[model samples]
Target: MISFFKKFEEEGILGINRRIGEYILPYNPREYYPLVDDKWKTAELARQFHVPMPYHYGLVNTFGGIRNTRELIKGRPGFVVKPANGGMGNGILVITGESEYDNGSIIFHKADEKKITEKELYHHVSGILSGLYSLDGNSDSCILQERLECHTFFREISFRGIPDIRVIVFLGYPVMAMLRLPTKESGGRANLHQGALGVGIDLRTGTLTHSVCNDKIIHLHPDTKRKLSGRVIPCWEIILQMASRCFDMSGLGYLGVDIVLDELRGPLLLEMNARPGLGIQIANRMGLLDRLRLVERIHDPADGPKDRVHRMLQEL
Candidate 1:
């Protein structure tokens, strides 16, 4: 079943790219993303816009910097060490807390048995510094960010790690949203193709629609068998507002805004994608071409950010 779906996805790549072009009309992924993919710039924008983001402790941009990673995270119990240039949830370590091993060594547990020794952690950071996670084998930076406590709304569904809300903002209006739930198969991460569930969310009501797992429609979770519908996401208004604001901030006609509901901080912006995935269409069981056309007719990028957000709410 998985293989069949995998082949289907591979076959649909061209169609996916075409749809993205249709939705993103004037913008091209290769042109915009490469320019905005800089992690430091993204963080600065989020901060300037009052978009809550995880607290970054330090960044390791060189071999000498990697040597200081342990010292940087010495007292921080819960934090995440990630590669700035990594894609598809790769090279991310979510330190749950701390633990003492039988060998009298301290270790950090990320979910399940995903533990890392001090030496292993150093080696991993070194690998990132050496360009293992960067595009074109270029040297990379490792960012250590404060681990957010996942909100209770996701406790029942998520296995570990933070599950993000992906909002597809078209021309400064939020057109669609999907709650990506993490699972054991995804190593407690929310990459849907890795066996997580993509639950479509109604923008107006904040209620869940049907869910898709591995490209197959399912009413219940594969692991928990919990019915997928009727799940109400918290902070729906804030999520939509943040997504719309990104369009104004970046002057991009279309984009995806990833937000996570932190237990203490409420909704926080994780990252912005110039070209979001087409799987959101499958999850919503709707076509992006139609939604894009509708939003384009309604939204005016010339409008100020506050007015644009109000216009989006009215359109919704």
Candidate 2:
């Protein structure tokens, strides 16, 4: 048991203390946080930078604007309602389909076939505007984003919700990446703590190599029961390029870029995280310290996004 921990330490498994003391504290500045913290701001910045992302319907900023929900998302066949300041996938309501009832009310269905009324949907969005999901009880807004359809390849492995790729970028280079797949236990949300499966991806090959669920290594998905390893992620190079570009857009030295693959749209940037979690180490069964150190040693401060990605692929 001690040797197991010793090997982890020797391989540079980055602990929370080392992450903060070494990376977050020195590399990330407070001012750059807002770029990734607020969902709306992140969307706007991605638009300004020409980063591909899901189509945004509109924002519900005030109580009065809540009435515009129907009109805002009228033509959107499917949409995601989420708090602009929410984290860990909280307060996110995904409406996959809608139908009108005889009483003139609309019914929305979730991935699990759970049905909700339009009034219930309005109340959920109202809670978001009331700051129910915000980090510090600050006023929040509701963003209506286009729902993404998972690529056919992932649909076989995922139980319900769409899977997303998380690429950790350090010094403008993509150091590590993992595929976050939603599970029945996670309520179809791609969050590790919520019981989602975190599968490690080969940095150069884009193939699934390892997987973890509830901190235990697994070879098959609990719900889908499909083999989790050896599957190749679609749009692998494009996803890494998109993640590398986020460094310039957000100006954060250490960043986590979340991207999703839409069946028709290829890869789209979903969100960004300044303080990315450490579960990725468990998924990869390796420490992030070594990968991060490699980035620092090879990354050039003057390299552009394209040059940085090229250098990283060649050297790392």
Candidate 3:
């Protein structure tokens, strides 16, 4: 079934739809830009808007920052070291704590069950510093951010790493949202194609509808076997408000806002993706062509945030 879907995604109706969907959705790859592409700019904007992001110690654009990584992480708990210009869920390290291995080698605990020796972690960081994770071959910056604890609500569904809420916000209104689940296949990551499940959500009710994994419909989790429906997300209203405010913050007509529900921190903004994935279409089993058209017809960027939100709720 997986192979069949891969083939269909490559050459069947699904493939064609993906191609057409890009043009139909205003926030498709070509239409949106990445906030992280410019590390300094991203930091400035995030700071200006009071968005809660991982605490950034320093950015390594030159050799100086890379050389002082030990100094940056000194006394800090386990933190995430990632490339500022990376994408596709690559070059990210989630450090849980510090420990020593049986072999007396110093290592970092990514989580309870995952550990990476200091040598290995340094090598990975070096690769990111050398631009292995950047879109182009250009040199990149590595940022050390505070690690966030996964919220309890997602404990049953998420394998590890952080489970983020990807919200499709159009014209300052949220149109669709899905909780990206983590799995072993995704290496504790939440990318949909990497074995995580995309659970569709009803925008108005904040209720789960259906879930899709690797293009196959799933009524229950493959690992936990828990029913996927009736999962009510905590802080649903706050998440919606944050997403709506982001449209004003970014000034972008359309965007995808990623919010991580931290165990203690409530809802925190992860990052904003201007060019959100079309895989959401398959996940939700609802084509975006009609919705995009609707947004285009009713959307007015000049609308106030409260008014826009009120209008959106009315539509729901």
Worst 10 residues of 3 by lDDT: 11-20
| Candidate number achieving the greatest TM-score relative to the actual structure | 2
By lDDT, who's the top model here?
2
Question: Mind giving the per-residue lDDT tens digits that candidate 3 earns over 1-316?
Answer: 9998875544422244553455325444442355535444566777898867667877666764566777778777778888888776788788878876688777788853677777787778788878898867577778888888888888887677688888887778777788888777777778886788898887777788889888889998777778878989998988888888887777665677888898888998877776567677676667555565566677876776666666776765
lDDT of 2 by residue, 78-112 (tens): 99999998898989998899999788989999877
Write down the TM-score for model 3.
Answer: 0.85
Per-candidate local distance difference test: 0.77, 0.91, 0.74
lDDT comparing candidate 1 with the true structure: 0.77
- Backbone Cα, N, C clashes tallied per candidate: 0, 0, 0
Query: Which ten contiguous residues of candidate 2 have the minimum total lDDT?
Result: 307-316
TM-scores of the models, in the given order? 0.88, 0.96, 0.85
Candidate 1 wrong stretches, greater than 4 Å: 1-14, 20-25, 28-35, 100-104, 302-310, 313-316
**In lDDT terms, how accurate is model 3?**
0.74
